[model samples]
Target: MSGALLEAKGLCKRYGALVANDNISLTVAPGELHAIIGPNGAGKTTLIGQLTGQIRPDEGRILFRSEDITDRGMPARVQFGLSRSFQISSIFPSFNAECNVALPIQAKAGHSFRFWTPAVVIESLRGPARELLGRVGLGERGATRASVMAHGERRQLEVAMALASQPSLLLLDEPMAGLGAGESARMVAFLKSLKGRFGILLVEHDMNAVFALADRISVLASGRVIVSGTPEEIRSSREVREVYLGEEFDA
Candidate 1:
C-alpha cells in the first residue's frame, strides 16, 4: 500500500448504446488481494476485461507501477507483469503439469517457439517452472498430465502457469469456479498463501472465498460500482445485503 501497484481511474466502457462500466475507479497495492463481486450480467467480468486490457475503456486511465497503461494492449500489459486467469478452466490438456508451467517461462525466457528443442532442456524455464509449482504446493505432481490430474490440481497448475510469467499483478477470474467443497477449500488455502507477494485482483463467485481473501471488496451492479469496503463492512452493509449478497445467501 506504500505505493499503489495498479490504479484505474474514471474507467468507462460502452458497447453500442449500452454502458458496461460507468466511471469505475479502484487501486491495488503490492501484495494485497482485492475482490470484485456481483451477480450475472452485472459487468464484473467486463470490468475485469477493462482492467487487464482485454477490453479498452471508452474513457479513463490505467496505471501499473506508476506507468500509464490506458491504451496498452493485452500483450503489452501482460509483459509488464499483469497476469490473469479465466472463469473457465485454462490449461494445456495435452501437456504435463511441468510443461504447462514451463511454457510461460519459455515465452518470457525468449525461447517460446523453440519446437526444435525440448522445452524442458531450457534451464531458465524448467527451474522457474518447478519453483513456481513448488510454491503452489504442487511439488510432486509436476510430471503428471494436466488432464489426468484432479480438478483442483489442474486449477493449481493454471495458477503455477500464471505465476511462471513473473507477474507483479494477478487478475483472477473465478479460479474456484466448478470446484467442489474440498477442491474449493484447497484453492482458497492456496490463494491465502499467495498474499503479500503480488497485487491480486480476484473475481470470484464463491462468497466464502471472497470474504476470506479480500482485503477490500468492490460490489458491482448493472455495470456500476455500488459499494466498496472491507469484509466486515461488506458483510454488514445494508446496501450489499439488499442488493446481491443477501440474495446469494437466501438461494
Candidate 2:
C-alpha cells in the first residue's frame, strides 16, 4: 500500500436501504492495471463515481499518490493527477478529435474556452493534443469529426482526452463497451500497450479484455469484494466462477 498510486478504503454508498458499495477496499500500485468486475447492480459505477469525486461516499476514504483525497471535488482531484473516462462517450460530436483533446489540455493549463477562436484552437495546445491522440492510436484521425468517427474511434478519442490532464492514475469505466469483435480486439491491444505507463483502474464486462490486461482483479458481488487476486487466481477460483465468471468463463 505504501507504493500504491491509488487506494480506496471502506467505500460505502447507500441509496436508502439499498447499499451500492459496502466496505469496498482496493488498491492500484504504481503502473499496475487493476480490473474491477461484477454483474449488473454490482455498484461498480457508484464506486467509480466516488473515486472520480463525482459522488460522495457515505463512508470511505480515497488516497491518490499518498495524498488523502476523500473530500476532494473532480477539479481538485484532477489537479492531483487523477483522471477518468466515462462509460458513455463524453466527446464533442461537432468538434474534431484534436479540439476535443485540446479542450482538456487548455483547461488544465488555466485557460478558459470562453472565446472560441483563441481558447479553443491554441497553437501550443494543438501539439500536445495531437501527441495524446497518437498515444491512444488516433494520430491520423485528429482531423476527423468526433460525430463521424465509429464508436471504437470515439472511445479511443475519449481516452486521448482523459490523458490530456497528464494523469498518474486513469480510471476507465468500460473502455471496451459497445464494440464489435474486431474493435474489441483492437481496444485490448491498445490497453495492453498502456499497461505499465500509468496506473489504470478498469471497470469492464469483457472477461477476455480484463484477463488480458489486468495485473490483479477484484471481483465484486452484492456490493462487496468477493475476491481479489491475480488474473489466473481469479480465473481458477470456484467462488468467483460461481458468483460472476461462471463455469463457462474460460478466462
Candidate 3:
C-alpha cells in the first residue's frame, strides 16, 4: 500500500481560552481523498489553517513526504508541493479566468510575476493555464473575467489555481460553500474525477458531497477528532450521529 502523503501528530492550537484544535492527528495516504466534517464552530477551519501553514499549531508536528514542515511558511509549503483552496472563492476578480490561473503557473515555474506584461501574451504560461481550466470544467470560460462568472465558476477557478502548483497533497477548505444544489453536484463530480490523481484533505459541510466523494471521513467536534472511519462506519456511529450528524440523517 502507498504510504502517507501528509501526516499530523498531536496538533494543538489555542486562542486564549478557546481551544481551536486539541491534539488532533490524521493522515492522508497517497492518492486518497480524506474528508473532515463537523457542525458549525467545530474547529474544522482551524485544522485546515494549520495544515496550509496559514495558522501555526501551538504544539504539533506536520510531516509531508516524511520531512518535517512544522516551521515552514506558506510559500515554502507550496514549494514542497502542498497547495490549498480557501473556504471562499480566491481568484483575481478583474482578470480573465485564464490569466488568473496563469499567474500561479508562472509562480510555480519559478518566474517572478511580470505585472507589466500581460499573462496571456506569455505562451508558456497561457497554454498550461488553458489546460488547467479545462481540467476544472472551465475550458470554454477561459477568457471570461472572474468577476463576471457565476459563483460556482469562480470556485472552479480557485481549484484550477490550486492545481497549477502541481501539488502532491491538496488542502480544500469548504469547496462546496455557497454552491447551489446543481452546482454542488457538479463540483462533487469534478472532485470525484480528481480522486487518485492527488491526495485530498477536504473540509466541507455538505454531507452528501462528503459521503459521495470521500474514501474516508473524520468527524471533528469541539476541536478534537471524535471518530475517523469509512462512510458506512461514520453513518452507523451513535456518537457521531448524536454529536454531529443528528438522528435526522438518513444514512
What C-alpha lDDT do the candidate models reach, one value each? 0.83, 0.89, 0.89
Q: In model 3, which regions exceed 4 Å deviation?
A: 87-89, 111-121, 245-248
- If scored against the real structure, what TM-score would every candidate get? 0.90, 0.93, 0.93
What is the per-residue lDDT of model 2 for residues 113-148, given as tens digits with 9 covering 90 to 100? 555677445887899999999988899999999889
Clashing pairs in 1: none
When 1 and 3 are scored with lDDT, the better candidate is: 3
Cα RMSD (angstroms) for every candidate in the order listed: 2.8, 2.4, 2.5
User: Can you give the lDDT of residue 245 in candidate 1?
Assistant: 43
- Model 2 is weakest, by summed lDDT over 10 consecutive residues, at 111-120
Which of candidates 1 and 3 reaches a greater TM-score? Answer: 3
Q: Which pairs of residues clash in candidate 2, taking residues 3 or more apart in a chain or in different chains? A: none
Q: What is the lDDT of residue 42 in candidate 1?
A: 80
